[model samples]
Target: MALAPEPGPDWSAALSHLVLGAVSLHAAVRSAPASRGAAAGFLLQALAATCTLAPGLGTREDCPSGAWVATVIGLPLLAFDFHWVNGDRSSANLMLGAGMALAVAGEHLGPEGCSVAGQAVLLVVAVTIAIVAVFTANTYGVWGGALLGAAGLLSRLDEDGLPLRRGDACRWALAAGSWAYCRALRTQRLQWE
Candidate 1:
């Protein structure tokens, strides 16, 4: 007999990520001079969204390997997310990258390594990075770090046998919408600048 799928919350949040990612992609395409960095961010967001949306082969219960990998890849890319809108702060991007990498590393450490402690550290670092982005007025990056950071911690719920829930959808939605917003806003500003 075939195995049954796990029961969980309806895919409202998961579906939201899919739509937001499409809109983000569209916005990125519209912004002609947007940095290659922004393109990378949009693509990563789409990948993560797709992974969560799938019910495909090798897809894990209430989540998939693809989703997990895509989400990880997005960590560093997020540092690049608001580049177009904020006109690029090379240093801020660098710090954001390093911070996210640290946070992700912390997750793998487990209880002995203080996995939860590491996650908390990440949340703090993420906020700090976003604040720096805000200080320089990197609107999208600010949004990117803030939302993605929350998303990062929330994905933890999917670890072990925890069922996928609103948290899963929320993080992806936060990421996709933030990217799309930054892209659209930047494109509009570029026309006037």
Candidate 2:
């Protein structure tokens, strides 16, 4: 039997990313001047998502690298912003930055390497966010951290051609985490104002 052609790009995933990106943009626009760093991280995600929204401009295969690069850079910015927003300079920001650096290095090693790198980035970002959440006493932030970590784990354990693929799970987790984080950012802004 002749092999059927593969399906086109996943429109749902792209749409979700676009929506999340828009939410992030709104948060950024509402944030104060100094706190815009966190919003900047989300903006990168938005940019990556926008690129993927166009089938001709960026196919799925072309999007992950952009997404990964954005995540790699964005997570630390968010972490550092938290550090400044909370007015508590912890060495954890340094560690988070180092972790992102390592993830970037690992991504260059190949698919397995990229998977591991992605996992590490997610874990570090999760842990950092969790720390910030604890300091802020924001329960939603804690859940956001958990979701991000779970997404990382799911991505790492994902295999090819599963009925419920890892990418879908990760996307859901990311969306939830992003929403929670956005809420947390809002709370932080309110507290400071």
Candidate 3:
């Protein structure tokens, strides 16, 4: 017997996960010192995720909107990480902002039949941004960036003629990444203070 088709996105499940992530991150940021920039970064990431999970919006147009939300949230989070690493706020913010801009451009051009290489290049750029973010930002930023990066790669895999299995794998990877980050952050806080 053939395997059954996978169900379409379950908006309710997505929304539930988004809410839990947002709330947990919000609390974590609140506990951190204001100088750490964790609060701002967490808030932005939560907003981006929530926007992406919004109901009744699943189309190419919705994707760009989601990408814009991700860009807005990701840029500053990346900058905070850079500042944490190099103590150069201005330069770090500028670089991250540029990356976000590129990500937005990729989202816009992707559905329009960009070449496979083009899509791959865009994903590489996004992953580079995430790598920088992981080192500079806190655990939350690290995990969120990783999830986003994985999602980007999985999306490219689908674009490049991979099976739907790749997309399913991407979804699971994203969920795992987010949950792991949240758990790690909580544990770190418990241990540190």
Indicate which candidate wins on TM-score.
Answer: 2
Model 2: per-residue Cα lDDT at residue 44: 70
Ranking by TM-score, best first? 2, 1, 3
Model 3, CA-based lDDT: 0.51
For all candidates in order, the CA lDDT equals 0.53, 0.72, 0.51
Error of 1 at 143 (Å): 4.6
Worst 10 residues of 1 by lDDT: 62-71
Off by over 4 Å in 3: 1-38, 52-63, 72-76, 88-91, 99-148, 159-172, 175-193
Worst 10 residues of 2 by lDDT: 25-34
lDDT of 1 at 121: 44
- Which TM-score value belongs to model 3? 0.48
Residue-wise C-alpha lDDT for candidate 1, range 1-193, written one tens digit per residue: 9889888955667567677667556645654355555455456556655665556623544343334333444434544444434555674466456545754674575544544543454465357547646676656646656665765566465555544564555555465545634553464355436
Candidate 2 per-residue lDDT, tens place, 1-193, comes to 9999999877666666677667656656655364667777777766765676665887777787777766777666666676677776675468556756864585467877776776777788889889888877988778889988887887767457455567666776776777787777777767788
Superposed Cα deviation of residue 141, candidate 1 (Å): 5.1
Model 2 clash tally, residue pairs: 0
Candidates in descending lDDT order: 2, 1, 3
